[model samples]
Target chain A: MDEIIRTENLSKQYGELLAVSDMSLNVRKGEIYGFLGLNGAGKTTTIRMLLGMIRPTSGSAFIDGKRVFADNHELWKIIGSLVEIPYSYPNLTVYENLEIILRLRFISDKGSINRVIDKLKLSSYRNIKARNLSLGNAQRLGLAKALIHNPEILILDEPTNGLDPAGIYEIRELLKVMAEKLGVTIFISSHILGEISRFATRIGIIHEGRLIQEVDTSQLDKLCRKRLLIDARDKQAVYSSLMQSGYSLSETKDGRFELLDEKAVRNPEVIATLMVHAGCPPTLLHVEEEDLESYFLRTIGIKEDLR
Target chain B: MKNIKATLLPEFVKLRRSGIFWITIIIFIIIPLMMGLMMFVAKNPAIAAKLGLVGTKSSLFGRNDWPGFMGLLLQSLASIGYIGFGFVTSWVFGREFSDRTLKDILALPVTRSSIVISKFIVIVIWCILLILVLFSTGLLMGWLLDIPGLSVQLFLRFSEKYFITSFLTILICTPVAFFACYGRGIIAPIGFLIISLVMAQFAGLIGLGPYFPWAIPGVYTAPAGTEGMQLFLSSYVILALTCILGFAGTIAWWRYADHY
Candidate 1:
């Protein structure tokens, strides 16, 4: 399918509160579509709607052109998902948990369970009950279940909620490989924008129950705001000198001068030379690009309001 | 139909591995054993006197005959079955919510309705096996203790009443499963179990046991034509309605509700 996963103005409401509002997006086959939002930004709600765990109040979601609904069991045969924190039957072993998924998926390969176990590197803990496995292992087990069938499309909501730094990195790399080499289409949601940006092919930032921005990962670096920051001895004098040189400088409350001018940031060496010649040589002069987290917040109007 | 078979394997695996299931089995075994102990005590007063409080409780059985023993078995199945069967239904359904695994099953290749039907199937198997355990243990204890009135006719009558009581008790579990899903955890369903038990007692006392869904099972097992314990064909109709509502409600909730 050209658009393996698509939503058309999907909305969910509870009484007066709108959990997801008129949200629409599409993920091409083999693309890792990152869904970024702050806590309670309707990421899970949207995922749930896509999975048909909850019905949309206003619009619809479709997987492989089939409209999602609880009874549309055929659509889920090739789709795998992990929504929110992953949970299994606590008493069942990790192998048994994945075995359950395999059975439900109706895959006849008895050895596929072991293959996923090896794929997730859970061989040692295969026989460990779900309750005894650490949070990271539990997460791996969840991913293992999602990938056991080698689905064409995978939908995950905060799949790395309880993983350590190493675990997160490993999972990110694994997801990248799955999408790049295996040609799996992944739709993953997370509050951590920076992490999702690392591997997501395209990203949609949601805020206040609405999708505010969608951008290609290749273009994300350019979309992040950048500024030329200048700080020197006699800062007021340096600010005055920059103003004298026809630099459109804005003094920040932190006593540093900032320049949003594209030219200044592009040629920062020229600004240093200009500052030294103007009798206030810069002690600190560098370009500051906004991090993904701040860019995410700004895109959502949370960080922008502060400025 | 194929989807149900697929869903059933996981349900059975989960049930098989749970500690609670074994505990339930042990409880089933122990109830009948305790009843047999009471039968033994009633047969021998000298041994009863030496037992003190145990003897006092055993005296509550009223007779040492096969009929009296069957009476105890029927009554115990009603009350204990209420708690036991309800618990099995609760754990089968509620563990999904308590453990937060409900979401994983919802969007599967198997339909939610199939998942629900599979769980009910497991509960049915669990209730039926438990009754068999109780009955088998009761027979063994009766043979070992050699209680009087051990005719084939008595055995057939008691077995038939026991099976019917067990069936009714299992029927009531449908609502328990509904409560488990509606309430979304073991605690809530168990709470509902307790409330129904209390309500059964109240309804039974007011001569309305035949009408209340929870009371109907207990009324059905009320000692083979006991004057006050009359169950009309209408009683089965009411109980059937409760089961239908509970079953349909549970399935609908799974299909339609926003299970966050």
Candidate 2:
């Protein structure tokens, strides 16, 4: 598998604070790689370094076999990026904004410009100046500008930030289309974990300026921590039965029991039977699976004080 | 050439939208027409004889032709226009950073040098158009006045003098061009013009005004043939230094200055 983006000991510092510290990662070609992190987790700093917007303090990154900052001219030709907030000339209309960029790219072909406009569904709003457009529309325009050059690699930081549900869905579909149909490698930084789970084929989680883990999306099931939650007639009997069975269990305030051990809590019905034999269960026996949220929390080593 | 074209197309489009081009034409045409009307008002024999315009001063002030007055007006306008050029040049780069258009511009495949060079080219073009409009205005006003053989002579002579004068303005205005790019606000560039003026005045007091960038315009305005080639050469030297400094300042800022 060819790595489209590779960082070797890449680090960034602002005065005494380390934004990204000795971090390294690889993004394979033709994959939607999710860069997941909390607020101020150095995702933007890493992306800035990758795009050659900010120089790394200690190390380096490469895109398509060229050093990022050293060979920016060559690297920029293949990579399109939207760093933080997307910005363009406020006075220029959507068409005018794109027209200026198209002219700058030396692409005078009217057909090609029209094609990008149509692809982004910005045809009707083409004449409207960017300042008058709402945030969602501006975001679409930003995405349109990034896609205008048709670069093979996209480094989009918080691409879906501040978007409505429909706009978010549209962006998700656009990313899917770009990755699946166009074979463009997408490196996205987003706080929307559910959307990232749905869209990303590979995810790298960063915390405290370090990459904690990189996992395949399919293995997310194994990464999940499911619970065999038991709600039985006899709460004490159910707890004692599960505890004697060597299953790690936790109790909730509402007289329910939580089986924390993943391997030990496989068969909820068998536990229910064992409770019945022990004269406990006459009503409910349920199992609930852990979601990506819990998995991320665990991977980041944050203990859930579910009190 | 392709890079120049790529850069120029956007700048031309910007000028068109900003209405700076049409505005220049209107001001150039209107200023002279107003002077011609004033000339008509002051044409009576008693008024003309009062200013001692009846004899040798005719070549300098003209009997009835507005070209001479228009030339004088343009000299003032050109000096002022020199500062205007700085504002326009500054806006070319300043607006990009202030309004956050630099990101879109840098993301394109064009080199960074092209962006800066193209704006410099546009400022130079604006200077050329300004000279043309002023000259044409003088010619039109001269035709209206019917100054007995003074029409064509004043038109050509004043045009030639203003043409030479505008070059010195371009040179003296070069530092303002650099200042415009470096300054973040409208007041900063205006402050630069003030500083340039002060520096030129001080230099003049010390007998070094000929070498200062701000003194080039006044150098050309030094009544034709008094100093002639000496004035031209001295102004040219200062202009060369201004160009070198402008280019150096522009390249340095474009490469390293971060847009906040």
- The whole-model lDDT of each prediction reads 0.90, 0.73
DockQ of each: 0.82, 0.32
Q: Which tens-of-lDDT digit does each residue in B146-187 have in candidate 2?
A: 644555666577666777777767656555656666775445
Q: Return the TM-score for each candidate structure.
A: 0.96, 0.81
Error of 2 at A32 (Å): 1.2
| Candidate 1 structure quality by residue, lDDT tens digits, B1-260 | 89999999999898888888889889999998888888999899999999999999989888898889988889999999889999999999998999999988887888899999999999999888899999999889988999988899988988899899899888888888888998999988899999999999999998889999999989988766786688999999999999999899999999888877
Clashing pairs in 1: none
Q: What lDDT is reached at residue B101 by model 1?
A: 92
Worst 10 residues of 1 chain A by lDDT: A298-307
TM-score, candidate 1, is: 0.96
**Where is the poorest 10-residue window by lDDT in model 1 chain B?**
B220-229
Number of the top candidate by DockQ?
A: 1
The candidate scoring highest on lDDT is 1
